[model samples]
Target: MLRMAAILILALGAPAAAEPLARELFGAMAKPSAQAPEAIGTYARGCAAGLEELPESGPTWQAMRLSRNRNWGHPEMIRFLKDLSLTARQLGWAGLYVGDIAQPRGGPMTGGHASHQIGLDADIWMLPPSRVNLSRAEREKISSISVRTEDQTSINGNWTRSHHALLKAAASDPRVDRIFVAAAVKVEMCRTAKRADKAWLQKIRPLYGHNTHFHVRLKCPQGSPSCQTQKPTVAQLSNGGDGCDETLQWWVTDYLEELRNPPKRKKPDGPPPKSAKTYVMSDLPRQCAAVLSSR
Candidate 1:
């Protein structure tokens, strides 16, 4: 609950005086598919048209945190999850336990991340699904485990080959742009995996706070011209070396410490404080404005 409260502060409640326009407008949109499922603008600051919801439960996967109503995503993302889960099952692993995809109309959310705004990113719990018969209440009550150690440099003892296999399958998928996991996991993979297969490590970029679940980001699909590309894309990361370079050490040491104890800031000298740099309609690609009011 403390983490959730902090997320609310940063993403939703920071500016206490008035709600951001993008937040207010996007928050009011409750239902999905009021328009076509088109992704517009970049992942961190964008909007989606015609959103689709993953099923509450699938044969090989189940969506969690349903009350947030963030199971919606673009058509490509929904299909990617379905296909990825199938691949996992074929790889002798259980299905995925999916997390937030996007809001009904991808934009600045009430809490959590900024990148899910465009429906191309999804979070899959590192926990392997045990069975296909999980209830919505079970999904809510069950918790994912933290694979990171106290120092944030390695996975806990509970880490298994299945976890590695599941993530590798996701990364190997052509449609996936990159998969974000704990930095320690990257170092472990670099040390243990075969030389030829190490190339896949490039896509498993390390980040803090994903010890419990890994976030998967997809490239903009063909024909989605409005979908903006991100900087230093997955292709760029793979060009020089496997992403398991010195960055892994930086992520665990400096980055992890910073994330745990962000610097304190005084209350706004001018105003209560405003939304993040990317949380406004104008900050997004112009096509996103149409996406916002398309219905």
Candidate 2:
């Protein structure tokens, strides 16, 4: 009787207060806020203001997945994409098939990403474009090719010299912070690149699920004082070397070995960690609420 009364008292003491998910709030916004452009927090836990949308069709590029409404980015990012597409044209390809940049008002997306909450990250499809005039339906129907082999040991026939040149050019750019590609792609590039021309390899990081599209993250542009830079900068992470030796080898060797022979471990006793999808508005910076509420 006492336990029941206690439970009843607790239940009746206060009303249930369930805050909505941040992604829901941000995702519901159909347009950017009317404010000066700024990146407000870390890539995975922030919001952007005054983001510009990349045109769906440009002379040198086409933004795919029109249904996702994720072609928006900062002005600097837009300029960089345009410049890179032009470089693609100069390299004998029609142009780039640009993938997701960010949502209209950059924040935690409803789905399909965890780090594009800022307007500085972009995904460039691996498939070299034959044409940049793809219709909305075509963009949705098409899929990018995997540059790596099925076993993930090395690059496939689709990995061409033009790809190497394009990635090298992107990594060498001043605005770029880092580029993420499959481990095999990095290994192949490392093997073929000349010693003197390999400095940019440090910025080419190896990540999983990037065989179809390489991700590019740009440095915080000028005027975005609130933008937080990624810690342990590329130079620091690489220890001033090109990271072509042990780091690249680990992916194919130990990583693959671990995958084949799974290690046994005890699960921790706790609730699951919070991710972009689970975040509430309070998990982000104070400025984000203002950005969300802005006119």
Candidate 3:
């Protein structure tokens, strides 16, 4: 009886053994399919860096925290800060923050759905008032009082030429996946970036937009479980669908027409898709069932 009791106590005190790798495989697959191996790796690295830079408990972190219902992304924020440091250094700006971090509650403009929910969004401060171009001076003055309270008037009026430059520089960065700026600012920055660096321009243009405050999104890193593979959508040809030959001709004609006269501003029809939904599962392929069962 004593020996049996000792064995029971010992068993109860011992830690459970680590689950087999097969269990880990099942757990991994149970998550959203968008989670790619490469993306997951990137996310892990990003999260580690974010944790180091951002304290788990603090006023700054609390203020920046997203609603509990949303999926807050740490890795994205880490990459943003890393990239912003480089951008600010090159552009001669002090730093980037959503609002005036110095003023406690002071942060960047927030209205509509900025990617701020995911910790990836940031509102960079515009250049000092003195440096703003006189020709566009009227456009640059943002009412500080109105901005703090989430006023739309203040948001629309506050954008400046310096802000445009900062956004342009950020958008041109290779790591930037997309940028949403005010329509007017997008046009100006797109044109400037295109002239300065054609490759960056091409990459950034498709992701461009005009909103009150600029929203910056970085590319899904190499190992994010949430990242999805995407391809440009083409209308599927049906029995009498728009034929390929006709579509090709139409594209050629439209391209030539646009080449002749470029507009000052172009608005997107709607917000861009935040993530790709399509997925290809390696483990889920036909041959996997036998292998999985054997194991």
Best by lDDT: 2
lDDT scores in order: 0.77, 0.88, 0.33
lDDT of 1 by residue, 1-295 (tens): 3323433443453563332457656766776646766788788778888889999888888899888889999889999999989977876657888999998888878777857988999999877777867877887889988877878867788678877877788788888888988888887877787887877778898876788899999988876778876778765865756776666677767887887899897776764433433355555566655555545
**lDDT value, candidate 2, whole model:** 0.88
How do all the candidates rank in terms of lDDT, highest first? 2, 1, 3
Of the two candidates 1 and 2, the one with more favorable lDDT, higher being better, is: 2
Each candidate's TM vs. the true structure?
0.84, 0.93, 0.39
Ten-residue region with minimum lDDT total, candidate 2 = 1-10
Winner by TM-score = 2
Q: What's the lDDT for candidate 1?
A: 0.77
lDDT of 3 by residue, 1-295 (tens): 3323323433455332221222223212211122212222121111111211232222111112222112223454545554664555455544443321111111111222322322344444333222222232333333222111132112345554556556666756666655544333433444444353444433232122234234555565554444332222112221222222443344335543564566577776896532111111121222222222221
lDDT of 2 by residue, 162-203 (tens): 999999999999999999999999999999999888889999
lDDT of 1 at 66: 86
Cα deviation of 69, candidate 2, in Å: 0.2
| Candidate 3 colliding pairs, count | 21
Backbone atom clashes (below 3 Å) for every candidate: 3, 0, 21
Better of 2 and 3 by lDDT: 2
Error of 3 at 285 (Å): 19
- Regions more than 4 Å wrong, model 1: 1-20, 254-278
Better candidate number, 2 or 3, judged by TM-score:
2
